[model samples]
Structure formats: structure tokens, C-alpha cells
Target: MNTTRKLLVLASMTSLVTGCTSLPPDAGFDEVSVNVEQRIANKVHWYTGGEEDAQVRQSIHDRLAQPLTADSAVQIALLNNYNLQAAYADLGISQADLVQAGLLKNPVLEMTRLKPRNGEDASLDIELRFEFLDILLIPLRKKVATQQFAAAKQRVTATVLDHAALVRKAFYEAQTSQHMEDMFREVTSSTEAALEAARRLRKIGNITAGTFDRFQLSHDETRLSLAQSEMSNRASREKLNQLMGLWGEQTQWLIEGGLKPIPFKPIDVNDIEKRAIANSLDLAILKHDIEALAERSGIENVKSIIDDLEAGYAWDRESSGEWSDGPTIELRIPIFDFGHARRARVAAELKQLQDSYYARAIEIRSSARALSDRLQSSRAMVEHYIDNILPLNRRIKDNELLNYNAMQIDVFKLLRAHEKQVASRQLFVQALRDYWLARADLETLLSGRANTVSDMRGPAISMGGGNEGGH
Candidate 1:
């Protein structure tokens, strides 16, 4: 075949190869959305500023019209959060790289014209050059880019999952804070009434000044605590709003649920470490890195001596219309850079990735075990309050009421028991919050999405005598 015909044939083959990987309209978000939906029942959308943007906005608006639940809150964030939408850009960028890798460089065309001094004769030369070596390397290049793109998808998917977990955590925190504020408000009211009664007693010289002062101080402190609870609730609610990408009227939305008790049940976590390592996207990404590097190392080793190669066709035509055509070849001789450094770098990276993957596996296993323990401890703490501490406080309050009715105890003792009972309930609320947080973290980890360690030690509920804790 003539050089021109051969080049045309090669071009035809290249075009045929590039058609295999055309991306869908949403890039790769369908897979991510499906994965998230399967795992958590959360729906995700990539807002394209098209008709779907209005749909998602309407969806979020509808969900926000009522009181928010944790799952709905996460779904809204996945659809509406600007940050999550921004994160979807990585998929687009990576998919572009993958598509680019599967194609050959464009052919370079050059034209040259010459005229004699007599101006009677002219020479025309035309040449076309392309990186013919690229055709051979396209598969390897695509292989590497494919793995890297897969890694990018995994990482971005992990980001979405982690975001969902944070939304859940923030939702529970806001819920607990809301309930805490209400409880403190009630406590303050009780304290105020008791202080007023004590004031009447002091006026009648029935109680000492010290006793009246204590009652007055308790009421003042309780009011101050109510103020603190209000601010805390505000802050937690605002954080949840930020995660859900809400502003304006959406910020005024209410969380529906209180700190409902999570059932205390035995969860088999003995295999959780193995499952975590298996599911962890972090390790999966490293595996892709290792695969791409290994493939790259083999390619570089095979082509170490050939730094650059190009071949094409050249044609020359004299002014008499006589034409000549031939194949042209160009090669770059490797004198100083034999790709030794490049090969060594790839090799080193491959080794580093291997070792790092091993280390990360260990870390994931440890984190899984730690999170499992935290989940169990949180569950135990919640159950302890429900089964022991709160019940005991209620019983003590009952005994105090009986003693007061029988004239065996003073009002001060009865009030003290009542305060302790309220503190236990407040503490129980925080314990439930911690239990939910730990559950979110563990589930995210086991699903191979997130690797974060939550604040297993829950927020303290402070009252007069002691602060409540879940640890």
C-alpha cells in the first residue's frame, strides 16, 4: 500500500478504538448514586443546572417543609449541598483523563514550498507525522488511566458517604440539643417556683436566710443553664443547616425526633475488622495505585531505550507535476536519559504503595475494632442509664416525695432529689446522642466508605452536682 493509504487505514483503526468508553450524561454519578442508595437508602444527585436542578430544589423544599429526620436530612444534603456537588467534579475530570488516554496524538501536517531564482520552477513538499508508538501504547495508557479513574470514583463515593455520616451525626446533635433546651427550661421553672415558696417561708421566719439564699441561687443557676442550652441548640442546628446547604427560610426548619433510645442488642463485631479492611475505599484506592504503577513499570521497562518515535508519509512534487512519495521515520536517541530515573521512580512508588497498603490495612483493622468497642460502650452507657441510673433516681425521687408527705424530710431534701432526677434524664439524652453518633461512624466504616473516628465520649450534661458522660 502507498504511505498515504496506510496512514488513512491507521486513522480508521484509531477512530474505531475510541468509541468504547463514551460517558453517560451524568458522568459516573449513576453508579455512585446506586451504591449510596443501596447502602443507606439515601439518594444522590449531580445537579447539572438543567431541569433536574429545579427538581432537586423542589425535593429539598418539600422535605424541609416538615420536621427533618436524620435520613431525610442526609438525602437533602446529597442533593442540595454545594460542597457535595463540587465533589462530583472529580468524576468529570477523571473521566476526561480516561477518555483522553484511549486515543492517539493528532497527526502533524507540514507544508514546504520552494521557488528557483528564475521563477520558472517551483517545488512543493508536504509531510505528515504522528506518534505511531502511541497506537501500541494506548491500551497500557488506558489501563493506567482506567485504574486511576476507578480510584477517583471510589474516593469521591467515600466522600459522599462520609458526608452522609456527618449529617447524621449533626442531626442527632441538634435533636439532643433541642431536647436538652426544653428540659432545662422545665428545670428552671421548677427552680423558680421553689425559690418563690422559700421566699415566702423566709418572710415568715420559718426558714433560715441561708436556706432561702440556696433556693434563690439554684433558680438563678438554672436560668443561666437554660440560656446555655438555647445557644447550644442554636449552634448544633446551624451546623446541621450548613451540612444540608440550607439558608434563609430553610434555616428555620425544625428537627422532628428527640433522642430516642437505640435498642441495646448484641451485635457480632468479631469479623468487623476483616470486613472493614475489605470494604474500606481507602485501601481500594491504594490497590488501584499499586496496579497502575505495576502496569506502568512493565511498560517503561519494555520501552526504556525508545524515548520518542514518530513515523508518517512525505510527498514531493516538482513544478513539472512529477510526484514522489515515501515513508518517513524519526527516533530520539537516549544518551543521557535512558528512563532509568523514571523507571526507578515508578518502581519506588510501586513499593511505597504496597507497603502503605499493608500499613493502612492494619490501621483500618484497629479503627474497626476501636469503633466496634465504642459502639458497644455507647450502647452499654445508654442501657445503664435506662436500666439503672435513671430508674434509681426516679425511685429516690419517689421516696423523697413519700418522706415529704409523711413529714419525715424537709422541702430542701425533696427538691434536691428532684434536681438529681432531672440531671439523670438530661444525661440520658446525651448518652443517646453518643450512641447514635457511634452507630453512624461504625456503619460508615463497615460499608467501606469512611474511616473517621467519632467523638465517642459524648457531650457532658452539666447540672449541680456532676456532669453526665457516655464513654
Candidate 2:
């Protein structure tokens, strides 16, 4: 009997020491790295910070090579971003917890000996028993775990959508900065030529000193403006790199050309509202949170403060060569703290959830309405710029240039006309950008198909057929 006891102790110790079990290895490290490298090389540009180069291009293509139209950017974010990847790891941990929650409790092993004061022999006994929660509680625990997992998934999805929207906005802003930089370069060159012409005219007594001074001032201002625009362009590029998860000086920078410019398609508010109701990830996450709250409420209602019930079977042998076998049952009675506070807290949380859902609904509706109105206004502004303002400004600038060349007006008038022309063009670009972004915002709120600029028409996506475009 002593031998058997020693053997059992050794066995338990061994099991405890080696408690952790190994799972099958996932994809091999070299294979995964190769896949990542291949994806980067062939797919999309991956930029984090600094200038763009071949390495960054390979990284982005590997990770984001697939078309991430504004509509699909959210999906890409969830699938590719490091943050979303971390969230997926959390999902695995939660699943493990769920498995534990549904598991049966291991048996308790007990050993004890009772000695008789006047007896020569001592009787030894052993007990081994297992207990499980009532079957009724099983479903409740599962429900709690299920709700938690659902909430986690929803959070990940919402995060993806938010990041995608940010990427689209930043991408467009960077492109705008690039365009402005190009314009500044052209303007500076033009100013330099005008300044040289003014100097020549003044030396030949064809222009006065004031004309030369104004020309020099314009040239200097244009140089300053060019420098400022270049700086801004660099800043915008860095921001895009940050969004693409590029860090350090490891990658190169470049915003690819071929952004399709399209006319804004008018959308009805009623249709948009319906789409928002059906497709909003924010709304879906809120609904999941409410369900999680409901589960927490259930957990509180059934939780026991002190009372517990246990029943199991045991067998033991005594040192005196006698054996005993029977079932054991134990019950704990509550003496104080009967779980009322826990129940109250859970009830309060449920109420809070109710309030939150209503607030979210109201906010979403209000946002949708406001975006719809802005979209209409922006479209009108875009039309006005395209059909009236831009055409008239270009014609006036051309006529002014002809008059200046004919020597009908002084150099100062020509300089003023150049400034006017540049300002008019800038305003036109701003109006067009406003229309594009307003439409993007409207689509974002309404969960429409027109969320990205790329979808305003570009090359078709190879996988997951959907509207693809970047604004």
C-alpha cells in the first residue's frame, strides 16, 4: 500500500511538471517569410517613413498589392495591418479561454490516516473524486464566452473600417500636396523668366526702376512659395508612409499616378439611409456590445456568493487490510453577501447599453443627414467651377497674356494677370477636391459602393469583386 501511494505521488508530480502540451507547428518560418517577401515584391507598395525605394515598393506590393479601393480598404486593413493582426491574436486567446470555460473539473485526490489512541495499528485511507458544475450552468458559461468573442470580433472590424477611412483621406491629401508642389515649381520658373526680362528691359531703358523692383519681388516670393510647397509635399508623403506601417529610413516614397478623375454621381438621401441601416459596421458592433451586456446580466443573476454543491464517488484501502467505497456529497450554505451587488451592477450595465445604443443610432442618423446635404452642395460647387469659373478665368488669362505681348499694358499688369490666373486654378482644384472628399464622406456614412476615388473607374480588381478606388 505504501508502494502504491509513492507511485501515485510520483505520477502526479510528473504530470504537473509537464502540464503544457504542444500544438502542431504552424507554417514554417522560412516559408512564411518567403511568402511575405514574394507578396511585397509582386503585390503593393509598402511605405512607412522617409523616401520611397525598391524595398518599400516591394513591401507594399507584397502586403497591399491587392486592390484596396475605398470600399475594400476596410477589409484590407483588417487582413493586413499589424494592429489588426494583434487583434487576431487576441481572438485566439479568447477562443482558448472559451475552451477552458466548457471544460470539466479534474478530480480531487485526497489522502488521510486516522489513528486510534489505544490501538496498535493505524488505518490509512485514500479518496479520489471529480465534480462538475450543474449542466444548467454549462450553457450560461458558453453564452458568456460567445458574447465576449463576438464583441472582440466586432471591435476588430470597426477598427479596420476606421483605419481604412483614414488611409483614403491621407492618400488624397498627399496627392493634392504633390499637385501643389508641381504648380509651385512651374510658377517659380515663370517668375524667374519674367524677372530676367524685366532686368533686360530696364537696362535698355524700356522699363522703369519700379517695374524691375516689382519683378524682383515677384521672383523672390515665388521662390519662397516653391520651397514651402516642397516642404508640405514631403510632410504629406511621410504621413502616407506612416499609414502604410513604414518606419525608419528603410523604404522609398512615391505616390503612384493614374488617379481617375470622374464626375460626381448624384445619390438620393433615402437610398443612402437605407444602405447605412443595412451595412454600417458601427451599428453592427454596437448591437454585439448590447448582446454582450445582456449576457453579463445573466451571469450576475445566477452567480452564487457562498453556496456550492459537490458530489462525487471515492474508494480507499486502510493499512489494517480493510477497504471502504462510497459516494461523497457536500453543500455550502451562504452566510453573508448573497451576490446582490453583482446582480445590481449587471443590471445597471444593461441599462447603460440600452442608452448607448439609442445614442449611437441618433448620432449615425444625424451624421448621415449632414453628409447628404454636404454632398449635394459640393456637387453643385464642382459643376460651377468646371462649367463657368474655370473656363472664364482661363480665357481672361489668355487675353491678358496676348495684350501684354502686344505691349498694350505694362509688366506690372502682366504680373497681376499671372497671379490671378494661378489663384483661379488653385481655387478650381480646391473645389474639385472638396467635391471628391464630400462624396467619400457621404459614402462612408451611408456605407455605399462609391466610398473610394478608385471606384470612380479604374482597372478591375482580381479578387473579391467589388467597387475599387482610392480617393
Candidate 3:
């Protein structure tokens, strides 16, 4: 073809493809929503401060209007948490990459003029060059990018589900601490009043100084326990605040409800092992990565042997008014490198991902079983505190009160019974908290993500059960 015709065709190609932009409207965000739909139905918002973003802000405000339950907390986090919004940027970047992958490299043009030795009309040359290989590889590049985009969406979904679980954990922690604080306050008040009675009894010679001192000690310990509970309540409140992305006045939000009672029915774990493995987001991401690597390996295999194979149109005008125009070709011969090193690198990475996938599956199965055991064990602890310990303490408290009223026992003995009952209640609060925490962790592992192995143990706090015979 003539130089002018070739130039016109290349220009036309660039324009046509320019209008063929491949960006998705919301860039696979809806797909991410679908991925996490099972875990949360809350709509996520990327806060870019437009009209839609304004609507999202209003939605968040409405959800945060009341005291937060677990669902509302997750909803607000999905819409308003800055980190979750930041996570959406991965989708944006990957979509941009996909768009870039489908596009051809911009055609390159070169022009020059040179006078011959005889000072003839300056010889003119013009060439338009582009990678034909890029045209052949567009589909492969898109395949690779599509897989990477899939991995990105899975990762974001995993992040969303994990954050929801974490918020649930934080909510329970906050509620448990609040309950603990209230219970300890009552214990402190009862102990303080009993101490006052003990002073009177000792002054009247109804009790020894040692007995009065013991009551004083009990009151002091109750005060200490109350203080510790107050600290825990404040700490847990701050953690929930952080997770919910609240600050300033927003930090004053309250939890709506308390933890539920432990159920006697155990959770069914018959297929949980296989289910966790199947639903694992980490495993899904690895599969995408491996597929992406496979596509990349195909590209590298070609590129390693022939890194650059560019073809173009060349035009020249000589001094004698004669013009020459023809096609031009370019290739980079691989003299030192035979693609062995690149093939080895791709093979190693593919194998690494394969091994990681298997390892993750095994780890997930074991964690599922361990967390299942932890959940049942937590229920048992709560039941034990209620059935074996608290009821017995309540009976002891009733008998001691009757004896004291009949003047058959000292006030100190009656105070000891009251302390034991309060101690049982304290243990019950701890067991209840641990039970809920355990359940949250187990549920998260089953659905949130695959890489995590949560610690089954609860935090070591003051067990504050007065077993001092009197305490």
C-alpha cells in the first residue's frame, strides 16, 4: 500500500479503538457485593463524595441513628468504614488493569530529513511502527487480567466478611464488659453495706476483730474488681469504636442488646470441614492466581524467544523526485537467552501457589474441627457455672440468711454466703462472654476467609470469684 494510505488506515485504527474503552461502569463492585451476599446483605459505598456518595452518607446516618446491634454495626462499617472503602480501590486498580490489557499499544511514528552529499532535495523518510505481537497477545493479556480481577474481588469479599466477624466479636466484648461492670457494682454495694454491719456487730461483741477485718477485706476486694471491670469496659468500647470508624461524639454510641443465652443444642459440624474448604476465599484467590500465572507463562514463552517483533510502513523520497514506499519488519534475536530462565521462574511460581493451595486446604480443615470443639466446650463452661456452681451458692445463701435471722450464726457467716453467690455470678459472666466469643470465631472461620486461624482461648481477665469460704 502507498505511504499516505497506510498512514490513513493506522490513524483510523487508533481512533476506532480509542472509543472502544473497556472500563466497567462500577468496575466489578457489584460482583464483590454478590460475593459477600451470603455473609452480609449490606450495601457498600465507595466514598468519592458525589451524589451517590451523599446518599450513602445519609444511609449510614440512618443506620447509626440507634444503638448498634451486630447487624447494624456491620452495615455501618460496610457503608462508612474508611478501610473497607479503601479496600474497594483494589477493584478499581484491577479493573483499570483489565482495561489496559485489552488495549493496543499506541502506534509510534518517526520522521526525518537529510541532505545527500550532492545537496539534492533533502532526502525524506517517515515510518510508523507498532507491535504486531501485541495484537496477537491481546486476548491472552485480557485472560490474565480477568483472572487477576477475579482474585481481587475475592480478596475484597474476604476482607468484608472478616471485618463483619470482627465487629461482631468487638460488639460482644463491649456488651460483656458492660454486664460485668454492672454485676460488680452490685457486689461492691452489697459488700460495703455488709462491712458496715460487721463494724456494729464487732463493737457489740457479737463478732471478733478478725471477723470484722475479713469483712473489710472483702469490701476492699470488691472495690478493686469493680475498678478492673470499669477499665475493661472502656477498653472494649474503644476497640468497637475503632472498628466502626467512629470518633469524637460518634464514639458515644451504645450497644443495643446483650449476649444471648447458651443453647443446649450443639452446632452440627458433620460437613463443616469440607464446607469451610469449599467456601474458602483464600483458596479461590490461589486458583485465580494459578490460572493467571498459566496465562502469563504462555506470554513469557513467546516473549523470551522473540522479545520485540515490530512491523511498520516505511516511506522515502530521494533527490530525483522518485518516491519509494514499502512495508518494514523488525525482530530482536535472542542470542544469549533461550527462555530457559523465564520458563523456570514461571514454573517455580506456579508450583509455589499449588503447594500453598493444598496447605491452606488442610489448615482450614483442622481449624474447622478445632473451632467446633471450642464452641461446644464454651457452652459446657456456661452450663457448668449455671447448674453446678451458681444454684448451689444460691441455696447456701438462703440457708445462711435463715440461720442469721434466727441468731444461730454470726453476721460474718451470712456475709460469706452472699459473697459466694456473687462470685458464682461473676464466673457465669466470664463463661458467657467466652462462649459468645468462641462462637463468633468459629462462624468467621467458616465463612469469612481461609487464611486465618483464630486463637480459641478467651482473654485472661480477673476470674473474681470469691471462694474464700467467706469470699
Whole-model Cα lDDT per candidate?
Answer: 0.79, 0.57, 0.78
Candidate 3 residues lying further than 4 Å off, grouped into runs, are 13-19, 50-55, 116-119, 202-211, 451-471
RMSD each, Å: 10.3, 10.7, 11.1
The CA lDDT at 91 in model 2 is 49
Off by over 4 Å in 1: 1-22, 49-55, 117-120, 207-211, 318-322, 453-471
Lowest lDDT sum, 10 consecutive residues, model 1, at 461-470
TM-scores for every candidate against the unseen true structure: 0.88, 0.74, 0.90
Q: Rank the candidates by TM-score, best first.
A: 3, 1, 2
Ranking by lDDT: 1, 3, 2
| 1 or 2, greater by TM-score | 1
Q: Give the TM-score of candidate 2.
A: 0.74
lDDT of 2 by residue, 169-226 (tens): 6766767777777777877877888888888899999989997898899899989999
Candidate 2 residue 69 C-alpha distance from true site, Å? 8.5
Highest-TM-score candidate = 3
- What lDDT is reached at residue 433 by model 2? 66
Per-model tally of clashing residue pairs: 1, 22, 1
Q: Write candidate 1's Cα lDDT for 1-471 as tens digits.
A: 265776687667656745555655776878888877777778888877688779878989999988899888998888888898898998998887777776666667899999977876799898887776676677777787777778778777878888888898899999999999999988887898789889889999999999888888999999999999999999998999899998988898878968766864666687898888877778877887777777777668656777678887788988876888888999988888888887887777777778878887887888888888999998999889988998899999999999999999977788778888888899899888888888888888887755563221111111101111111
lDDT of 2: 0.57
**Candidate 3 lDDT over residue span 161-279, tens digit each:** 88888888888888888888888898898898899998888889988989889889989998999999999999999988888888887776777766778876776777989888888
